[model samples]
Target chain A: MMKNKKMIILLVITILSLTVLTACGEKKPTLNVYNWGDYIDKEVLKEFEEEFDVKVRYEDFGTNEDLYVKVKQGGSSYDVIFPSDYMIERMIKEDLLVKLDKYNIPNMDKIDDRFINLDYDPANEYSAPYMWGTVGIIYNKTMVDPLTKWADLWDEKYKDEIIMLKSQRDTLAVALKKLGYSMNTRDMGELEEAKAELIKQKPLVYSYLGDEIKGEIVGENAGVGVVWSGDAVTMIRQNPNLEYVIPEEGTNLWFDAMVIPKSAENKELAEKFINFMLRPEISAKNADYIGYSTPISAARELLPEDIKNSLVAYPTDDMIKNVEIFKDPTDIIAEYDRIWTDIMSEE
Target chain B: MKLKRAAYPYIVWMMVFILMPLLLIVYFAFTSGDSQSFLDFTFSLNNFKRFFTPTYLKVLTRSVNLALLSTIISLIVGYPLAYIISKEKSKRQNIMILMLVIPMWMNFLLRTYAWLTLLGRNGFINNILAKIGVSPLNLMYNNKAILLGMVYNFLPFMVLPIYSVLTKIEKNLIEAAEDLGANSITIFRKVIFPLSLPGVITGITMVFIPAVSTFVISDLLGGGKYSLIGNVIEQQFRVTGDWHFGSALSIVLMIFILITMAFTSKIDKEKEGGGGGLW
Candidate 1:
């Protein structure tokens, strides 16, 4: 009986090794794209895969910081990544992204001139604009007065009826902007002042959220929230009484962009994917599905007139002038993180 | 000869799955770089030094305190429930245990998110409180929320071990104590409690270790407002891009847990007169 058991064990080991070798040998020309969750349409992905005959593996992250960490760790090789404006700048400084060869991407001409020469990736050398929007107040008109500024988040009337993003950059930017300081202020005193103001506003705040804030706001559980314009558009569609406003004191203007990582092995496939996404019809579909503004001029023409004219989707030129794009604070990140944590820990 | 062949598969499985990954964590903990090449490994102490910072130390202590609190609370709540279940008829005992563990079959994150919906400012609890003209409590994004979440998640760990031990106790011992004119309280203290000591120790260790390392519940329930040690270690790998520091924090946490386990074992040995043995 014992001899029979030994023979069975040997047979099992042989079978397992064969399976492992077979799995490792089957490799295909593939592209791995990492982006935010609920930001892509499945039909578009299926179409891209069918047309190119290349396997597309997609992953998601809740925040840009989460994406940055995974790319930095070098755990998985990603052909493409979508990072926000400041994060792209940081990755560039760290020499983590590969420069795009514009020769291969004919659709680069479809993007508007406004998005091409942004400070994050000057001259459109390393990254392509994927989506762009402003941070703003999303509120239910029936539950509260119109909120027009960051300070309105601290109003006692809306106590426990407000939600804010939990990100250090966005929350701190709002506090800094409300205190009349630069959003990227590196001065220690100004940051401390901003931290104090945020602490004071904490009592009236409900909770910090990201994508989940939209459902809460739409359910009428939250009266106002600091949310992205894309999420606000989704919430407004669900509850027409919802209104979005770019705070009077100004807010951060952020953009998400696609870039190839320096460690990417399939550069050709990555470029092909970027060019595919930039096609006007494809870009318009993405914009309609994600409910975010498109930077492609051709796509904008295809949008419905009401969506094209919506101020929340496309802010007035004057409002755009007041907004500032975020810059990468290379060495000052640790200080900002420390202040944010300390503020959160306080009573 | 037959035994040697039979042991080969088990040995190979252990070496491949368990021992290999442990060896890798140790290797990477010492090695430094964004690349996989280990050419410039100089055996540095910098990674370990980062854990000595006051900020990280405070988070570590807070994690230990919260874990201890959760373990103690779960033990208090779970012990009576386990005893009651064990006392039930054998057929009912299985059903009761199944009912207790049914919630655990769902994904942990989903359950935590469900709690968020039930406890948020506009959640069910607050809505009901508001209807009665009472002010809603700030319960979702605070220490209270973290504690409630920890206890709810880990209570089963405390229950199963104690219940298993309690059910195995012979009924004749308790009957003999009652026949000898001993009161119910005295019999329970002497006969029942000592026999269940091993389960209590196992339950405490099981609940405490996971609670200390738990990051997601605290992050979601605590509103990312409070920084626990788990969050600090996560930030090192995620935000700071400092793998060396993260490995050091992990080593420190490992050392702390080892010391705790050692101390608990020593106490248990003394209580058992050093010869009864844990096994």
Candidate 2:
């Protein structure tokens, strides 16, 4: 009887080893998703892996331009990517993205109607809205007086204490909006006016910054910064004294959307991952992990009441009426380039 | 035959990595890159023409100007220090050189980032100043800060060459100058200075070229307040996706550095022909 039991155990071990060998011979199909660094929840990826039983290869890109270049250079194959509205428009124009099959993405209805049919991806043909946010003034109240407007950035008292966004569009948009002009205006005269305003404001600017503004503001290096909403929320948490104010002049409203690249080898799996991300629970978890406002209305409902009602994260409808989205300024970006170069090169 | 065969890998490396990229740059520099396709290009001078604008010219000149200023400062600061170190006992001289080189062991970016902490508005220096009831000075986000970062980063480049040359100069020459009734000043001006010319030139070349082409120091210390030529080229390739224009600016920057290099090589040849060597 003991020999018989031993023989049964040995037979089971042999079958298990054979199964492992075959599994190694033919691996699961993998889906590669490249996104902005630290832009997603860790647990959501694990959930996708378990639910789909497909291998997941995740990579992070520092910037949208870096992602575009990687795809253009054909160095690495990526199944899906997260790009902002302007970059999405550029990709669509360049034919770098594959059109989404709406049938596969059943959770697309979860995305708020307000977030859909935008200039960057009209009719939801190519991209699904992920996280949306606005750019605004993040200030340390102790160092700065109640900062309420873009003009407050150029206040003489804040000289050498202001940090402006480093990107040409973001900074130029601030100047344009301050002057009550449209942010996406290609008119050279308006751009020049904006340039002059920026030059005038330069002496007050301690540093032109990117994502590092959060650390700088929270650390009290600068009194005020023109920063993104999600980063502002993070900074406010780090330093309770710091407050975020979207200036009365208005700001840039941006959406980062997920879309599959045309070079993706596993389109079906990529669509599955996108649909997985849009599931209300997954989206809410992601929104809680990442401070950015969720685009899905269902996900927004799931957010903690304090964060969901926060004026900085979700501004009132009347307040955001004048806010503009960046259209892909393809033809005359060179002009903005020239203006920015001139502005930066000024002695 | 064995030695030649051993060099085969490096030759392949030079062809694949170095020469090919350079040739590709030249190819891109002359092409109209509206489409960004490698094959579908027209031979055009538009890239070069775009470079002649006053805006770009001013940026180029500013980069050169900043580099020249940093080189001059490094020479002034490094020469005396190198001389002092060379005049020390051999063991102490090695210690001094090592001390000069220790900071470089840390990454250049790390060293520059450290400067951000020390010179920032609310950084350590300002914290100290505030204790004494002194207003914090704006030590960053300007040309001066950029110059400081460049000098701090590249001073070793300047000092090592000068120190090497100074140490190599024969003590007998100094003794002979003194025996001829020449004072220390005369010995330094005529004998020591003239003999260190080769090292000075090498130091200048090393410091000036890197300073002129540096994007990181300016980006970090200058706080992206102003655009240098290096910044322009970086934006063209990385930010704007205009590799053709970037290649053109690179070619232009290359021409500037090449002129300095050629001029230095000519000086080196003259020094060698005129018996700049002592031993």
The candidate scoring highest on DockQ is 2
TM-scores for every predicted model: 0.88, 0.92
Q: Please report, as a residue range, the 10-residue window in candidate 2 chain A with the lowest summed lDDT.
A: A329-338
RMSD of each: 3.8, 7.2
lDDT of each: 0.84, 0.88
| Best-fitting candidate, scored by lDDT | 2
B110-147: candidate 1 lDDT, tens digit per residue: 99999988997779899999999989777787788999
Off by over 4 Å in 2: A1-28, A50-55, B1-3, B273-279
Candidate 1 deviant stretches above 4 angstroms:
A1-29, B1-54, B126-139, B273-279
Q: lDDT tens digits, residues A1-347, model 2?
A: 99999999999999999999999658978889899998898788988988888788899987677788888788688998999999999999999999999999999998888988999988779999889999999888898788899998889999888999888888999999999999989788999999999999988889887776777788898899998898887778789999998899998999999999889988999999999999998998898888888888788799999788888888889878879998887677667778889888887
Provide fnat values for all models in the order shown.
0.37, 0.76
